[model samples]
Target: MNNEEYVFAPDDFVLAGNDHDAFIDDTYFKQSYWKDMLSRFTKNKGAVVGLFVIFLIILMAIIGPGLNEYTYDFQTISHQNLAPRIELLEPLGIFDGSETMSTSTGMVEINKYVSEDGSLTGLEDTYYWFGTDVLGRDIFTRTWEGTRISLYIALVAVAVDMLFGMSYGLISGYFGGRVDMVMQRISEIINGIPTLVMVTLLIIVMKPGLGTITLALAIRGWIGMSRIARAQVLKLKEQEFILATKTLGAKDFFIIFKEILPNIFGQLIIMSMFSVPNAIFTEAFLAFVGLGVPQPLASLGSLISDAFKSFTTHPYMIIFPVIVLALIMLSFNLLADGMRDAFDPKMKEM
Candidate 1:
């Protein structure tokens, strides 16, 4: 065609210099709600640090027990009531060669039971890094071991909530009639009794141990999750997509599990996060009251209970467990808060 004949018409579509199409809008990233939520969550410095702390605690719980030479139950009166000592710190002049810790009562040292001549009376091979209990069990090993048990209980409790509780509420609320009323009534009956009283009764009947503690926590644990799930399902079931799926002949189970469950995962997960710390605390309390794991099988609460006798003399025993429990509970709280902010649109707006 001649150049003059090829003159652009008024309605001719003109191309930019580049041939590639720019179909994606420049504002797409800005409009992404999920991406912006994540950015906002990461900006919360406390949450990020809390996440890191949790990772370290988990790592310690997994690997720390094995690294120490002493077993959690290993005990000897010969080396009883030793104090925390870092050999490396000795070289730095921060700690002397002796295992001595400054306490509110007085300066406490390792009770090696030396004679007046200054010779080792206890077994020479064993070393207590974080000190020892009255029974001479290694505190460092016991601490990590207790951490393992506590984390395990929390994990199992959270799983019970997410699995059974989530399913129960989904089924009940989706059905929305007799099933809902019956299921909700059951949950309410369980909720009617105080957790402490029910757990106490269960403990007496079932025999107090790790298994009993886990069972009690799980039995009551799902109540919160079920309530949350029911509310979420109540809202979700009213949406147009859910109505459309029902009209399309989707089975109740399929609709609830496949469609509804995935949509409410964020809320469910947030509930699970909050549940973990609560479960951990309950286990600790049960153990403290002598209804948790039996003797020789250390847990954070049991360790604290054991220390109660000589707590004034050997406060480190109480202090260490308290610190670990505090760390775990606080970390989960921060993580839950972060996740809520990251997943909830309303929080992202703030």
Candidate 2:
């Protein structure tokens, strides 16, 4: 063996026995599209953070009011224009309400006021956390109430839009030619009118309530979604699966809903995410203009509307509401962006 000599090829070299298959991990064989998407979504820090924040917001909307003693509309001039009492340094027992805060020259202290029974009464000097509004309604409670209202409008509006839009687009795109043309032309007519203008007119007729805002937005909101769905259907309808489904005598409804709908679902999801924020903003605007949910019922917009009048005297009035609204919109946007990237195979390639 020691005397054996190895020959070397001049032009090329070939390696002998190497087994590479043993190194592959179990994960290589245990992945799926959804898992891939979820993996990618988790990797996006902004999207994940935004989504967590959104969840927190929803939880806040659900449980926040119950945790607090104050009702959103329960007015008590005793607490009006009170600054928030968060006591950020209170946790370690620093500024906790156990000790009286210094009622210095410029600061306000809890006051005593007469009750409706014509008797003098004193209020509990509790934390106002988010302070009080002009009418002395708890701003924190009202903000949550407004969140509930705005969320209601947004979800209902988006649902209406999705339902109507998906059906309209499926029918129109599945059956092209005259039917498509007629449907598209009709949509164009509806789209020609400014959505806000139409909604404004409708609000005038309906006189501003949850139903009115939902109806007004739904009346026109479906058009945009329908157009998006229609375009996607047109593209996918010409694909091989659709062609095979048509050849197999699948009913038109079956072809459209079953064969075509699932493939384009990702887009619908992303679009819906976007629509939620838009609907929330729209409702807030309407409320700001005095066309939102009626009086006594609070919405974020209505809160802002009320805040504007006391801007100089009470800047905190606007600050809290604006922060809540901005957070909601930003969260939705970031979540949608992440969802789009996660769900799109093309994005995965990039």
Candidate 3:
């Protein structure tokens, strides 16, 4: 057939749509940057679960210590070493306030609420949900209080990292040349020292308490944040918008805080989130090693440390605190991973 005749009919000719309607119609709703980020975040089931768990833990930390009639420091020698017993679950024979004492005749389960005469002990009405430690202090109260302390330590670390670290990095990166070199060298020197050694030294020099722990964490924790901020600033300072701001004679401080900060804020937030678990774990470790907050005031690490002494005999003592601490670390890590993917969708795994 002739070429002209083949295209002659109107029905034979079709318009090139190129899926333009699909592109233009845009069935999805328009969302702001933050909304989009949050949408992405919520889509991650692991992250969502982690967030919920963390929120629950935080709430528990706030109120768990207050749930029982007994205060964290309340001590009763008679109630010492009592196993966990929930009044509601007592019939299930689980957490029934019984301790398996190793007698000459082998393991003997003794119901602490009852005496050898099968009569109800006067203290039968009293319950220790998480049981009592050697000192008879309620474990439930101490656990929550310890969690509260861990959260406080994490908050302090994040604050120091954001304020001092971010500021230091911004200045050093923005100034460049001799300023960057000197600042980086100083950071390197600080970073070179092992964190454990420094914290231990600080604990030795100062009273071992929240203040000393916070100070120890702040000393080198901020260095990592500074390095990250410096890298981001170095990459962004020469960008066209930044150069335009510089051309407008914007002050250094204004440009650094007002201009640069907003752009890298997401990354910084993700970094801060990651830093939380690290801070918490570090504080726990310090407490475990006996350098944490002094007795009476407990941290998770300290609780674990105390519980470890009788772990073989009373394993329940160590279980509760360890579970809480592990959950916190895992939850924070999962949340941070979600935030990272949300902020930078390009980082999402295939």
Clashes of each: 0, 1, 0
> lDDT tens digits, residues 268-303, model 1?
998899888988998888788887798889999998
- Residue 61 lDDT in model 2? 93
- Where does candidate 3 clash, by residue pair? none
lDDT of 3 at 86: 88
Question: For residue 286, what is the lDDT in candidate 2?
Answer: 80
Q: lDDT tens string, model 3, 168-281?
A: 998999999999999999999998998789878897798879888898888888988998899999999999999999899999999999999999988888888889999999
- Looking at candidate 3, what is the lDDT of residue 265? 87
Per-prediction TM-score, please?
A: 0.86, 0.82, 0.89
Q: Could you give the C-alpha RMSD of every candidate to the true structure, in order shown?
A: 4.0, 7.3, 5.1
Q: How well does model 3 score by local distance difference test?
A: 0.89
Which sections of candidate 3 miss by over 4 Å?
1-23, 27-29, 101-105, 348-350
Which of candidates 1 and 2 is the stronger one according to TM-score? 1
lDDT of 2: 0.80
**Candidate order, TM-score descending:** 3, 1, 2
lDDT of 2 by residue, 1-350 (tens): 59889787775865554755556586685568999999989999999999998889889999888878889879987667766665565466432323123444655533222234656545434677777877888888888888888778768866866789878987898799999999999999987987568767887677778888888777777887888888889889999988899899999899888989999888887878878888889889988988888889988998899999987667778888989999998999899889989999574353
**TM-score attained by model 2:** 0.82
